[model samples]
Target: MASTIRVRATSSGETTEVQVLIQHPMDSGFVKDAKGETIPPHFIRELTFEYDGKNVFIADWGAAVSKDPYVKFSFKGGKKGDDLKISWIDNKGETDTTTAKIQ
Candidate 1:
């Protein structure tokens, strides 16, 4: 779907702070279009964040989530040069995956 995702990570002592932005339509199906037709539901259902091949965070989303959702999280034991992978699956069966290195 060519979705755009941005990730940022930083380490401080034993904790690493991570932030991510995902671009999506996130239609709730309850919404109406210009023709007053109900829009089909489309939203990210599952999101996972992995640190150096280990799960650091996970999210189960709903239609109520806004478009271009932004997420923030912090985890212990993340160091510089570690890999942070972010992946999501949408209700439409589309998926997006990205990775970032902690700075």
Candidate 2:
């Protein structure tokens, strides 16, 4: 499946607030499909947020997490023009990444 990410960043004085929405099925492998077969687990294992090539925030997730997870965080020293990158790796070894400029 193709995953999509949306990121928004806004600065307040010296701090920048960041929020993101990641698209994924986040299946726990316990749910049965319409055909009565278990849907194998497919969830994001790790998510990282980087600012200016430096890690600012990271999350370790599992099947328990909800689909299309939303994460919000903040960091210092980020301005409007700084580069923000977000990426995720799922349990199925699938990965996707996206970048945005802080607004």
Report the number of the highest-TM-score candidate: 1
Question: For model 1, where is the 10-residue window of minimal lDDT?
Answer: 1-10
lDDT of 1: 0.89
Residue-level lDDT tens digits of model 1 in 4-103:
7788999996899999889988899899999999999999999999887788899999999998898898999888997888899999898989888898
Error of 2 at 82 (Å): 1.1
- lDDT per residue, candidate 2, 7-70, as tens digits? 8999886999999998789999999999999998999999999988899999999788898899
RMSD of 2: 1.6
Q: Predict model 2's lDDT versus the native.
A: 0.89
Distance (Å) between predicted and true CA of 89, model 1?
Answer: 0.6
**Model 1 Cα displacement at 97 (Å)?**
0.8
Model 2 misplaced regions, further than 4 Å = 1-3
Error of 2 at 46 (Å): 0.6
Off by over 4 Å in 1: 1-3
